[model samples]
Target: MIPQLIFLIIAIAAIALFTINIRKIIRNINLGRPEDRSDRPAERFMVMLKVAFGQTKMTKRPVAAVLHFFVYVGFIIINLEVLEIIIDGLFGTHRIFASPLGGLYNVLIGSFEILAALVLIGVIAFYARRNFLRLKRFTGVEMTKWPLSDANNILIIETLLMIAFLTMNAADYRLQQLGAQHYITAGSFPVSSLIAPLLPNSESALILIERAAWWFHIIGILAFLNYLPYSKHFHIIMAFPNTYYSNLEPKGEFSNMASVTNEVKAMLDPTFTPEPVAEGGKFGAKDVTDLSWKNLMEAYTCTECGRCTSVCPANITGKLLSPRKIMMDTRDRMEEIGRNIDKHGKDFKDERSLLNDYITQEEIWACTTCNACTEACPINIDPLAIIVELRRYSVMEDAQAPSSLNNMFGNTENNGAPWKYSPSDRFNWAND
Candidate 1:
C-alpha cells in the first residue's frame, strides 16, 4: 500500500508538470498573428494521415527511415506495458493483466521484447550516425552545442529506458523461477530470457534490482515527457497538427498581407481617400509576432533534420544561407520572447528583432526563392515564407535593400520592367 501510494504521488506530479508545460507551449504558439487554416477539412485529414502517421517523406532516406520507424513503433507499443505498470502501481497488483490476457499477453510481451531490442539497436545506430558518421545534415552550423547535446541526450535516454525495461523483465523472470510470491510466469520475454541467467541468484536481491529498474524506466519516461517541450523531439507530438495545417496552396503563391493589399487597392482607386498610417504599425514582420501563426508553428515543428538545408542551393553553393538555421533562429527568438513574456507581461517589448539580430541581410538575400526548402521539408515547414517576410520588412520599412535590388526596383517602377531598358527596348533583347 505504501509503495502504491508513493507511485501514485509521483505519477500525479509528473502529469501536472507535463500538462503545465504543454499549455505554455500552446500559449506561446498563439502569440503570432492570426491565420486561417480551417479550409478543406478532408484534405487536411488525408495530409495528416499520410505525412504524420504514414511517414511518407521519411522513406526518401531508407536506412534511417527504417530505424526511426522501429523506434517510433516500439515506443508506441511499449506504452501498453506502461499502462499495465500504472495499474500495478496503483492497485498493488502484480501482473494485473496476466489472467485476463492469458496467451495473448505472452504474445504481446514477446513482440514487445523483439521490438525493444530493435529500438535499442536503432537508437545506437542513430547515435553513431550523429557522432561517429558525422552526417553533414546533423552537424551543420545550427547544430552547435545544445542542439547536438539534445539529440544525443534523447538517444541515450531512450537506450537506458529500454535497457531498464529489459533488466526489470529479466529480474522478474528469475524471481518467478525461484517461486517468488508476487512474480508471475505468465508473460514471455524472449530478449530478457537471455538476460535472466546473468542476474543475481538471491531472490531478495533480484526483487530489489527489478524494483529499481521499474522505477528508473517510469521516472525516465516522465522526465522525457517534460523535456519534449524544450527539445526538438517536440515534433513527435506537433507533427500531426503541423502537417494538417500545412499550406496547401501552390508553392509559388505568396500570401498577400491584408494591410499592404488594402493600401495598394486604395492607391489604385482614385475615388478612395488614403487613411493615415497608424503609429507603430509596420508593413512587414520585424519580429516573430509579426509573422502568421502558421509560420510560428512551422518553427515549432522543425525536426532540425536538415533535409531542407541539404537540398538548399544557397547552402550548397557556400552562401551564408541555411534554411534549417533560419527555422532554428526563428524558434530560438520565439522562445526568448516567450520567456520574456513569462518574466514580464505579454505587452513587454524586446528591443531586438528577427532582422539583423537573429538573421542577417546577407542570409536573406542568398535565397533563390526556388521553393526547394519547402519541398524538401518532411513536415511542410516553409522557411522561405519567413525569409520573404523579413526581406519585405527590410525593403519596405527600412529601405535598406542592396544596390542591385534598388536598381531593379527603380527600373520596375519607371520602366514597368526589372530590366534597365524601356518598354520599347524590350523587343531589342529578343532581336539580339
Candidate 2:
C-alpha cells in the first residue's frame, strides 16, 4: 500500500510538470499572429491521416521509413502494456488484466515482445546509420551541438527503456517458473524467455532485478515526457496537429498581403475598406510574433531531421539557405522570446529580432521560392512559409532587397512587367 501511495504521488507530479511544460509551449506558439486554419475539415482530417498518421511522406526514403515505422508503431502499442503496469502499481495487483483479457492478453503480450525486439533493432540501426555510416542528412551545419546530442540522447534513452522493459519481463517469467509467491503464470513472454536463462538463478536476485527494471521503465517514461519540450522528440506529439493545420494550397500559389489586397479592393468597390494595422506593426515577419500561428507551430514541430535541407537546391548550390536551419532558428528565437516574456512582461521589447539575429538576410535571400523544402518535410512542415515571411518583411518594411529584385520591382511599376523596356516600347517588340 505504501508503494502504491508512492507511485500515485510520482504519477501526479509527472502529470503536473508535463502540463506546465505543454502550456508554456502553447503560449509561445500563440504569440504568432492568428490565422484561420479551421476551414475544410474533411480535407484537413484526410491530410492528417495520410501524412501524420500514415507517414506517407516518410516513404521518400524506404529504408528510413521501414526503420522509423517499427519504432513509431512499437512506441504506441507497447505503451498499452504500460497501462497494465500503472494499474498494477496503483492497486498492488499482479497481472491485473491477465484474467479479464485471458488468451487475448497472451497474444497482445507476445506481440508487444516482438515489437520490443523490433524497436531495439530499429533504434540500433538508426544509431548506427547516424553515427557509423554517417548519413549526410543527419550531419549538417546545425548538427554540431545540442541538435546532435539531442538526437543521440533520445535514441539511447529509448534503447535503455526497451531493455529495462524486457529485463523486467525476463525476471518475472523466471520467478513464475519457480512458483514464487505473487508471481503467477500470466502473459506470454517469447522474447524475454531467451533472456531468462541468461539471468542469475537466484530467486532473490531475480525479484530485485524485476522490481528495479519495472521502476526504471516507468520513471524513464515520465522523465521522457517532461524532457520532450526541450528536445526534438516533441515532434512525436506535435506532428499530428502540425500536419492537420498545414497549408493545403497549391505549390505555386503565394498568399498576397492582406493589407495591400484589401486596399486594392477598396479602390474597386465603394463598400470595401482596408483593415488597419495595429500601432508599430510592420509589413512582414521580422520576429517570431509576425509569423502566423501555424508557422510558429511548424517551427516547434521540426525535429531537425534535415530532410528539408538535403533537397534544397539553394543549399545544393552552396547557398547558406538551409530550411532545417530556418525552422531551428525560428524555434530558438521563439523560445528566447517566451523566456523574455516569462521573466519580464509580454510587452517587453528585446532589440533582437529573429530576422537578423537568428536567421540572416543572406540565407533568406538565397531561397528561389521553389517548394522543394515543403515537399520533403515528413510531417508536412512548411518551412518555405517562414522563409517567405522573412523575405516579405525585408522587402516591404525595411525596403531592403537585393539590387536585382529592386530593379525588377522598379521595372514592374514602370513597364507593367519585369523588363527594362518602357510601356511605350511594348509594341516595338512586335515589329521585331
Candidate 3:
C-alpha cells in the first residue's frame, strides 16, 4: 500500500512539472521571429544534432568540459537507479535492476558515485577561480551584485544528491546482511556487511528508513526541475537552441539594407526620400522589436559567466565595453520595452525612454568589432553585432559619429581613404 501511494505521488508530480514547464518552454520558443536568410530544412536538423549531442562549444575549456560531460552522463544514468530505489522503498522488490543486468546496474551506480564526487570537486575549483584567485585574465574584477546565489544553489543540489547516493548504499548494505544475494562487479562498489550491525534487526525499521530517503531524493529532483527554468539552469535548455541557430555569417554583416528605389527621386523629395539603404535606412535597431529573434534569444541565454568579457580585447585594453554587460543591457531594454508595450498599445511610444536615454553614443562606438566575445561565448551570443548596429544608427540617422569616424567619412567621400594624400598615392606605393 505504501509503495502504491509513493508511486502515484511521484507520477503525479512528474506529470505536473513536465506539463507546466514544457508549456512555458514552448511559449518562449514561439516568440522567436523569422530569420532573414533562406531557410534550409537540413540545416535545422544538422544544428539540432550538433549542439544537442556534439557539445562542440564545451571543448573550449577542456578540463571543465570533460568534467561536466561526465557529470551530465552520470546524472542521466543515475536517474534509472533513482526509479528503482523509489520502487524498492514502496514495495518489497527492486525489480528494475535485480535481474541478469544487475551487474551492469551496480557498475553504473559505482561509476556515477565517482563521477559525482569529481563534479563536486570541479565545481569547488571553479568557485575558487572565480572568487579567490580572481582569475582576472579569464574573469574581470569579480562583480558580486547578488552574492553568487546560482553557484551556491548548484553546490547544495550536488551535496544533496551525493547524500542520497550514500543513503542508498547504506540501505543496500543492510539488505545484503539480511540474506539478500550480493552481486559484485568491478569491485568499485564495496558492499559493507557492517551496516547490519548498525541497523535494527527488524525489517520494518529498514523499510521506513528507505522510504524516508526515497521521498527526500524524489522531492529534491522535482523541486530542481521546477526551479531550472527560473535559475541559471535555464541555460541547460536554451544553450542547445542558441548555439544551433547562432549566426554563421561574418560579424560585420549587420542586416541587409533595404534597396533604394531611385537616387534622383529620393534626393528631390526629402520627405518622400528613401533613406540610403547604406545610410538613412533602418541600419541599427531603433527599439526592442527591431532586434532579430536570434538576438533576443542570445540575451535570455546569457549565463552571466563573464566568459565573453574576460576574452574581450576592448575590456582587456581598458575600454568601457564589457561584452557581458552589453548582452545584459540589451535583455533589460527588451524586457522594459515589452512591459511598456503591454501596459500601452503596440503603437504607444515613450519619447523619453530610459533605454535609449541611458546608453551613450560613445560607448556604442568603443567596440572594435572584435569577434572574441562571440568566439568565447558558450551559448554563441554575438555582442559584436549589437555594437555594429548601434554604430550604424549613430552614423546614418543622427550624423553623430566620433571625430575619427567623421574624418574617415569625409575622406571616404573625398578621396576614398581617410588620408589627406592624393589618390595617386595608391600607385606611388606600388612603385616603391
Candidate 4:
C-alpha cells in the first residue's frame, strides 16, 4: 500500500510539472500577432499526416532515415511496456498483463525486447555520427557547444533508458526462473533472455537489480519529459501542429502585411479610403511580437537539423547567412522576450529588437529571396519569411538600405524599372 501511494504521488507530480511547462510555452507562442491559417482544413490534415506522422521529408537521407525510423517507431511502440509498468507500479502487481493475455503478452514482450535492442543500435549510430564521424550538417556554426551537447545528451539518455528497460526484463525473467514469489513465469524475453544468464542468480540481488532498473527507467522518462521544453527535442511534441499550420501559398509569393496592403490599395484606387495611420507607427517586424504567431511557433518546432542551412545558396556560396542560424536567433530572441514578460508584465517593452541584436542586416540581405530553406526544412519552417520582414523594416522604417538597393529603388520609382533610364529610352536600347 505504501509503495503504491509513493509511486502515485511521484507520477502525479511529474504530470503536473509537465502540464505547467506546456502551458507556459503556449502562452509564449500566443505573444505574437494573430494569423489566420484556418483555411483548407482537409489539406492541412493531410499535410500533417504526411510530413509529421509519416516523416516523408526525413526519408530524403535514406541511411539516417532508416535508423531514425527504427528509433522513432521503437520509442513510440515500446511505451506499451511503460503502460504495463505504470499499472504494476500503481497496484503493486507483478507483470499484470502476463496472466490475463498469456501467449500474446509473451509475444508483445519479445517484440519489445527486439525493438529495444534495435533502438540501442540506432542511438549508438546516431551518437557516432554526431560525435565521432562528425557529420557536417550536425557540426555547423549554429551547432556549437550547447546545441552539440544537447544532441549528445538526448542520445545518451535514450541509450541509457533502453538499457534500463532490458536490464529490468532480464532481472525479472531470472527471478521467474528461480520460482520467486510474485515473479510470474509468463512473458518471453528473446533479447533479455540472452542478457539474463550473465546476471547473478541470487534472489535478493535480482530483486534489487529489477527494482533499481524499473525506477531508473521511469524516473529517466519523467526527467526527459520536463527537459523537452528547454531542449530542441521539444519538436517531438510541436512538430505536428507546426506542420499543419504551415504556409500553403505559392513558394515565391510574399505575404504583405494587411495594413501595408490596404495602404498600397488606397494609393492605387483613388476612391479607396485608407484608415488613418497613427503617428510613429512601425512598419514590418521590429521585434518578436511584430511577427505572426505561426512564425513564433516555427521557432519552437525547429529541430535544429541544419538541413535548411546545408542547402542554402548563401551558405553554399560562402555568404554570412545560415538559415539555421536565422531560426535559432529568432527562437533565442523569442525566449528572451518571454522571460522579460514573465519578470515584468504581459505588455512589457524590451529595448532590443530582433534585427540588430539577434540577426544582422548582412545576413538578411545575403538571402536571394530564394525558398530553398523552406524546401529543405523537414518540418516546413520558413526562415525566409522572417528574413523578408526584417529586411522590410530596415528599408521602410529605418530608411537604411545598401547603396545598390537605394539606387535600384530610385530607378524603380522614376523609370518603373530597375534601370536608370526614361520609359521612352527603354525602346532606344532595343533600337541600338
Candidate 5:
C-alpha cells in the first residue's frame, strides 16, 4: 500500500507539471495574431491525417521514413503497456489483464516485445546517422552543441527505457518460473525468455531486478513527458494541429492583409473607397506576436531535421538563410518572451523581437520565396511564410528593402512592369 501510495503521488505530480508546461506553450502560441483556419474541416482533417498521422511527406526519403515509422509507431503502440502499468501501480496487482485476456494477452505481449526490439534498432540507426554516419541533413551552422546533445540524449534515454522494459519482463518471467508468490504465470515472453537465463536464480534478487526496472521505466516516461515541450520532440504533439491548420491556398499565392486588400481595391477603382485601418495597426510581422498563430505553431512543431535547409536553393548556393534556423530562432524567441511574461506579467514591455534580434535582415532577404523549404518539411512547416512576413515588415514598415528590390518596386509602380522603360516603350527593346 505504501508503494502504491507513492506511485499515485508521483503520477499525479508528473501529470500536473506536464499540464502546466503545455499550458505555457499554448499561451505562447496564442500570443501571435489570430488568423482563421477553421474553414474546410474535412480537408483539414485529411491533411492532418495524411501528413501528421500517415507521415506521407516523409515517404520521399524511404530509409528515413521506414526508420522513423518504427520509432513513431512503436512508441505509440508500446505506450499501451503504460496503461497496464498504471493499473498495477494503482491496485497492487501484477499482470492484471492476463487473467481475462488469456491467449490474446500473450499475443499482445509478444507484439510489444517485437516492437520494443524494432524501436531499439531504430534508435541505434538514428544515433549512427546523426553521430557516426555524419549525415548532411544533421550537420549545419544551426546544429550547434545543444541540438546535437539534445538529439543524442533522447536517443540514449529511449534505448535505456526499452532495455529496462525488456529487463523487467525477463526478471518477471524468471520469477514466474520459480513459482514465486504474487508473480503470475501469464503472458508469453519470447524475447525475455532468452534474457531470463542471465538473470539471478535467487528469488530475492529476481524480485529486486523486476521491481527496480518497473519503477525506472514508469519514472522515465513521466520525465520524458515533461521534457517534450522543451525539446524538438515537441513535434510529436504539435504536428497534429500544425498540419491540420495548413495553408490550403496555392504555394505561390500570398495572403493579403484585409486593410492592404482594401487599399489595393481603391487604387484600381475610383468609386471604391478604402476603409480606414486602425491607427496602431502594423503593416507586417516584426516579432513572434505579429505572426499568425499557425506560424507560431509551426515554429514549435519543427523537428530541426534540417531537410528544409539542405534543399533551400539560397542555402545551397551559400546564402546564410537556413530555414531550420528560422524556425529555431522563432521558437527560441517565443520561449524567451513567454518566460518574460511569466516573470513580469503580460503588460511588461521589452525592446527585443524576433526579427532583427534573432533573425537578421540579410537572412530574411536571402529567401527566394520559392517554398522549397515548405516542400521539404515533413510536417508542412512553412518557414518561407515567416520569411515573407519578415520581408513584408522590412519593406513596408521600415522601408528598408534592398536597393535592387526598391528599384524593381519603383519601376513596377511607374511603368507597370519591373523594368526601366515605360509600358509604351516596351516594344522599343524588341526593336533594338
Candidate 6:
C-alpha cells in the first residue's frame, strides 16, 4: 500500500509538471512568427529530420557525438523498462517480463546497460576537457556562470543512474540465490553476476533488498524528472518544437517592413492597431517586439553550447560580437519584457527605453553582417538577420549610422557600388 501511494504521488507530480510546461511551450510556439520561404518543402523537411534525428550538432566533435548517441538511444528506450519495473512493484508479480516476447525485453535491457556504461566514459572525457584542458576558444572572455555547478550536477546524475542500474541487477541476483522463480532472474545480468557470491543465502534479506532497490530506482527517476525543466536538460523538451518550427528558407531573408503612411497612421491612432503592411514604411526590426515569433523562439531554444561563437569569424578574429551572447541578450531582454507585460498590460510602452539602457549602440554597430554565425549554428539560429534589422532601424529611422556604414551607403546611392572605379572601365580592356 505504501509503495502504491508513493507511485501515485510521484506519477501525479510528473504529469502536472509536464502538462504545465508543455502548455507554456506550445503557446510560445503559436505566436505566429515569420519564416523564410525560399527553401523547397522537401529540402526543409530533410534538414529538420537530419538535425532532429541524425543529431548533426553532436557529430561536430566525433568522439563526443558517438558517446552521446548511444546514451540518447539508451535513455529513450529505457522508458519501457522503467514502466515494467513500476508495474511489477505495484502488482507483486515477477513474471511480467516472462511473456512470449520476454527475450526481446531482456535484450533491450542488456543493450541499455551497455550503452549507459559507454555514456559514463564519454561524460568523464567531457569533464576533463572543460575543467583541466580549459580550451580558451570554448570558455570565451566571459566565464560561463555555472561552470563548476553544471559539471557537478552532470556527474552526480550520471553516477546515480549507474548506481540504480547496478542495484537493480544485484537485487535480482540475490533473489535467484534464494530460489526465486528462474523466470524472474534467468540468465545473469553482467553486473549482478559479480555480486552474487557476496550475498547471504537468506530469502528474507533478498526480499528486503529487492524492495529497497525498487524504491531507490523510482526515487532517482522522479528526482531527475522534477529537475529536468530547471537544468541544461531543458533542451530535451525544447528541441522538438524548436526543430519543428525552425526557419526553412535562405538565411538572408529578413521580414520586409510596411510603408510609411500605414506606420504613421498606426502611431497616431488612439485605438490599438495591427502591424502595418504598407510598402517601404520601415524595412526591418526596430525593437524586440518588432522581431518575429520565430526569431524569439530562436532566442529561447539556444543551448548556449557555444557552437556558434566558436565558429564565428568575428570572434575568431578578436571582434566583440559573440553570436552566442547576442542570442542570449535577446532572450534575456524578451524575458524582461514578458515580466513587465505580465505586470502591466500589452499596451505597456517604454520598451525602447529598457532595451537602449541595456544593449549599447556601439555593440549593435560593430557587427559586420557576415553570415558566419548563422552558418555555424547547429539549430539554425540566424543572429546575422537580427543584427542587420537593428542596423536598418538605426540608420533609416533614427538617422544614426557609423562613419564606415555612412560612406558605404553614400557610394551605393550615388554609384551603385562601394567601389571607386567606374563601370565603363570594363570596356577599356575589351577594345580590339
lDDT of 4 by residue, 102-136 (tens): 89998999999999999999999999998789888
TM-score for each candidate, following the candidate numbering: 0.96, 0.97, 0.76, 0.96, 0.97, 0.80
The local distance difference test score of each candidate is 0.90, 0.92, 0.63, 0.89, 0.92, 0.65
Q: List the residue pairs that clash in candidate 2.
A: none
Is candidate 1 or 6 superior in lDDT?
Answer: 1
Per-prediction backbone clash count: 0, 0, 1, 0, 0, 5
Clashing pairs in 4: none
lDDT string for model 3 (1-432, tens) is 766786767768876987776665444433334455346647755765666556677688797678667666666666776677666655645545656565775676666666656655666666666668866643443344532666557657866765666565566556555654431222134432323366566656765665566667777777777776555566667777776776766665655544434555667777675554433335455554445667767777877777788777778878777887777676556555555655885556676421256456656777777688887876678877667766666776668888887988888878978876677686886676
Model 2 per-residue lDDT tens digits across residues 185-233: 9889999999999999999999999999999999999999899999999
Q: Where does candidate 6 have its weakest 10-residue lDDT segment?
A: 25-34
Give model 1's TM-score versus the native structure.
0.96
TM-score of 2: 0.97
lDDT of 2: 0.92
Q: Which ranges of candidate 3 are over 4 A from the true structure? A: 1-33, 36-52, 80-97, 137-144, 179-209, 250-255, 259-282, 335-362, 420-432
- What does candidate 6 score on TM? 0.80
Q: Candidate 1's error at 404, in angstroms?
A: 0.5
List candidate 4 segments past 4 Å from native.
275-281, 427-432
The sequence of per-residue lDDT tens digits that candidate 1 reaches over residues 70-146 is: 99899989999999988988998888999999999999989999999999999999999999999988967788899
Winner by lDDT between candidate 6 and candidate 3: 6
C-alpha positional error of residue 283 in candidate 6 after TM-score superposition, expressed in Å: 5.2
